[model samples]
Target chain A: MAASNIDPAIFEQLQAKIDEEGRIKDELKDIIQQLEKQGRVTQSILSRIHNTPTGQLGPAVFQPCERSILTQIHLVKVLSDIASKHPFYKWNNLWTREMQNLIFCLQLRHWLAHQELETIEQVGNELGVPINVKDRDIFHLTIEEYLLALTNTIDELTRLAPNAVTLGDFSRPLQISKFIKDIHAGFQLLNLKNDTLRRRSDGIKYAVKKVEDVVYDLSLRGLLPKQRSSDDTPAEAKGGAGAPASDMDSDVFLEG
Target chain B: MQMAGMKRSRDGPKPQGRADWDSPYIPMFENFRAELDEHHDRREKIIKASRDITASSKKIIFALQRVRNLGEKIPPPLIKSKEYSQHTSTIHERFVSVAPDLKGINAYRYQRQISPGIQEFMEAVLFRHYLETQSILSPSESAKLISENVLLTEDDYVLGLFDMTGELMRYAITQMATNGELPASRTGGRGNILTGLQDLRTKLEALDVSGSYGLSKNAEQKMSTTRTSVEKVENAVYSMTVRGKERPKGWNPGMDTSRPVGEVEG
Candidate 1:
């Protein structure tokens, strides 16, 4: 298709979305800056914890760690902002838990920075969480894993509040199905051996298939497209070989 | 020794073998030797001619390069001038004088001024040449093809463009981070970028327009995977940037601001 033939409405919408994304990214830049300042204090605290033995605690247990406190407050604020902006109907408990974990990390950083090593165990005990750095590799969690977790949490929330997440106005589910089929065809063409490529293709195909199935079910229930299989065929021919002809005719018409 | 002496005696000089040895057969023998030498030379010349033909044949006999550049490299002859008749006569004589066994001679000799067909052939050859030189299509060429032919809206075009741009940015950021010029961010934060892109894609799909631009299942999945790798690079950049912030001097949070937001407006 030529660029001249592009659907103007869709183009406009896409342009709007792109613009919105740019704005969000700018906002994130400012947020990252604020977070970085807090990150410094958190890093110091983490470093201290690293120095201390598992069971031992350092001195200076009562001093107020301004930076660490500020870091926790900043993190909570960010989490709240994200939750509010999230399109999901209900914010998942996982987000809250993640935020809490962040707070603990901040507090742990504070303990280390102030040389209040002895209080580390106490702080962990009070929070009912173990300070097993070796076992809990918080720092090692990859971004992909983190995003997967976040998306999964969002998915769960969407499931809980289906009405909150508005269904896309277009036939997105069908597009997704088509996309999956194309990807499968592409993979067959490339004949790649890389496991990563295979897995990626599989993942896309699965997501598209899922969306297709949902759309199909919705269409069957008259929640999506109103046209029914019986609407096109004669009642007597509905259950017989003639049914296929009706389907073919509809498909041909739709394509045209 | 006795046998040797007897042989010598038998073969004793016979009066110089007949005065001047001028028998009639003498002239015949000399003539025969001369003819034999001529035959040997002729055979050699024939062998040399055959070798020349074989060598020329082994090499490209036809000027393939000239044929390849027939229209573009060579100028077509002017046919309407006073020299037309003379030129035609010369061409005719050259054609008639060439080897009779040559194939496609008539077609070759009938060539006229360069036409559109010739131009197209030349273009195809040039295209093949470009392909050989470049080995693969350049990104710009790919983008041009996509923009001109792919059934997509301006939004889809822009989105695909940004997708490519984002990949480049991520690569740069990763390189910078590795060089210790940028900080890598925390893990979960990187997904925000992918999430943002995904949101845009989802929104685009939600539009009511028929046959909007979208990912193929394979492309979407590949995109997802690519997104993860990009996120990893983003994390590294964020980490480096955050780490850099710890240093009192040269810290500027605004430096990490994402740009071109206004330009993307619908």
Candidate 2:
């Protein structure tokens, strides 16, 4: 059947409602910008600590960055409240679609602050957001977005490997190599589609190779431990043994 | 691996489960996935409707073009014609059909997705209007003509006008090649496509539109293209008039004579 023209009053009302939605979207965008700015500052400050020696780095290195991340968390909480007032859950997956970068940065910071991945429940607990509330009623990062953020964090760690070797931190390279390899193994278990997650998972191998190269360079100069693992597999455990790169089980040291 | 769905009730009385705050069995948000599906469905409907509107609007432009040689009685502008009214009504009907689905979605948010169809429709409508009545359309009048609820923003309106100038350039060249009746200037001579184009340029230039957020640059680029189209029309008309004197008597410019019009000696 052919459609008819809408009633004038209903049309006007719809226009007004759409206008209100647009206004709210603009406000949300402004808040997102603030969150992004704070995230960048937190990243730069944390990067300073990543390069500095552990003993030389004072509490001051983490204090200001923690404050910045907390501010971002507060902004996210405020955005969550504002988003709940509208049907934002139905509105094009706005959390992941419009603010993927912002949320990824937040997750990266939260992961850096604590060595472990930041669980959704932990973030809600820290921010005083009710976890038991019905889904879609709360705005939290999805696991997929967290995994994407984890990929970015791994990329940052890979970049830090050469700096660690240059700064006479031989142990840091082994730690980073072991950490990233564990992440790569976890990614292998997942059946990711041909999207950001799969693309990022593909990048994990390059990070592993980069860290291995740093370790190899250090070991050539007689800087690496003779056998760091303390296992009977001396050939594979040594840093520059030139073991095959395609062994899938070689990096499966940490199981999620 | 546990990806929970997110959904919210749009309109209803508050559900009774709020009172049981300590109930160990909280229902999983199964309905949230339904909302995402609905959003996709709604977008599909609007896109289909916009396509229909674009097709019908093009037909209206063709119909308006049929009356190009009406010998001065073009029936009170083509927009007031039966063909124009019928086509515009259908466009409004399609727009109204999608109104319910787009309740909370700002039309501008999808402007990038949907504006091509709309701007093409605008080009057809504005071109017909300009052919019948030699005045350019204001943004407000365009908004009203489009529909009451749908806001044809100034940026889109100006962008549509930019395309309309291109169409007008083609129309002017065709009209001069066939009928040899030029677009009238204030001085009122036979060949005046240049005057009409100049008027349009002046009117568009007078608009205060520097702050239209990214649209300003597009409008500027299109404005230059519109000027080029106008120049093409002017050059075509200039050659036609200059070479017309060299043709023999009783020469119908519309006719496909044995020789090129420029080659025919007086």
Candidate 3:
């Protein structure tokens, strides 16, 4: 044993490393806070989707939604710029929830206009970023992030199905129903782990069933466009705000 | 799985002039399925490798514990033996095998899957370094043990250092019991196990990682555990001193005989 068994400089260096990590997190947190603020405004703008009619959705919802999403896109670039300098997962927790929210906004806006789930590539294209990067140590939307966002978009559209019918756009509910079922079916293809993404995705079945109920209610009243109907008992449709309570109606969602 | 073959004829003519399919996103999902599967497979590889690395590291620590003295090579019988060789090689092989999966961006991507092994390895390496040199293992020295493809974050390193303190405490207790004295220099210098433990405690206590993320979040529990370890050694040393006069002739509380103490730290 030497007079100095442990060097003082060792702890000093460790402290320096700890402080450096703290500094990086603070800088990233500053940008994430800005992203979070922008994300909120974008969400407030997009929430207007519920009241706006299908025909008026373009000028009323799409225009404002796209503008807000563009602002969030800029903050995302700033977040990504600083984040790229460090390991992706080191500070991913600081921004992942907000990033997922931003992705959901993009997916929702794209879906409203095009009536198709925005591909991860389309999401990256609109944000001016890379999608599902495999090799590079750069900022990109991961597949898990994209899938989580897509599931969130499906949840949003689930709320929209019945709203579209409430606004007398009888056909919009049918479109949303098909789209949500498609996305839910997409989720079924994934072999998910028991994590946050899996839990969020697991709820997609409920979203599927909810949208199915809206469609079933519409078709029962002869409100369907007279094509490809899965008939439900009119008596059962009168109860339960289009809940998939009966095994018969749930079978429609399962098989479809 | 096949895309549902059912017709999309019922959904009001497919809202956007897009060609209707029962599920239009199948091609997109097929791509996602492949990507996710690759991610999971890579994740599983790291996880299994991590498990082996962790188990081997624990065994290495156990083997190192058999040595009775500090500031020297692990005795030939304890470390140069076949069992020690197996643990060291197992750790090396597992680390090398998992390095490619942890390369570049994926290093941090699969950190959750791989971090447990790295932390345990750090503890073993740090303990060995302390036992051999009676000095702290710098982060750079630790970096040499880990592969270049793997990223070792400061959080893992600090947490590993925290765990190493418990090993030191155990070593001190065992030494005091076997040798009828605290593990210290024959010259009675301050560079003994208790001083080293207190020095470590002071440094760890001074750290200010208060946030709810990374090291700070885990530091709370580990810090308390570290505190308990130091106190255990302190209490054992205190009892030995208070009870020294009452012991039977040549009777040791933790030792059967006092061997020739190592001459160190004049």
**Count of residue pairs whose backbone atoms collide, per candidate:** 22, 2, 3
Model 1 C-alpha lDDT per residue in residues B1-266, reported as the tens digit of each score: 01222122121111112343233224333443454344345434433433333232222111122222111222233223334334334323332332231112211211111111222222222222221221112233433432121122233333343343243334345335334443212232322223333443444344432222222222454355545655655564565566554534333323444633233221
Q: Is candidate 1 or candidate 2 better by lDDT?
A: 2
- Give the runs in model 3 whose Cα sits over 4 Å from its true position: A1-4, A226-256, B1-22, B187-190, B249-266
lDDT of 3 by residue, B129-153 (tens): 8887777888888989987778777
**Candidate 2, B-chain TM:** 0.70
DockQ of each: 0.01, 0.04, 0.35
What do the candidate models score in CA lDDT, each in turn?
0.33, 0.56, 0.76
Worst 10 residues of 3 chain A by lDDT: A231-240
Each prediction's RMSD to truth? 42.5, 13.5, 7.7
In candidate 2, position B253 carries an lDDT of 46
Q: What is candidate 2's lDDT per residue for A195-226, written digit by digit as tens?
A: 67679878888886777677555544445543
Which wins on TM-score, candidate 1 or candidate 3?
Answer: 3
Q: In candidate 1, what are the lDDT values of residues A1-256, reduced to their tens digit?
A: 1111113454465446545545554554455455555655554554442233322323322133454655555554664465335321122223433433444453343322331121334443443333322222121222222222222322222221222113222122222233233333333333333434335434544443444445444344333322233113222211221123233213213221
Candidate 1 lDDT for residue B257 = 49
Best first by TM-score, ranked: 3, 2, 1
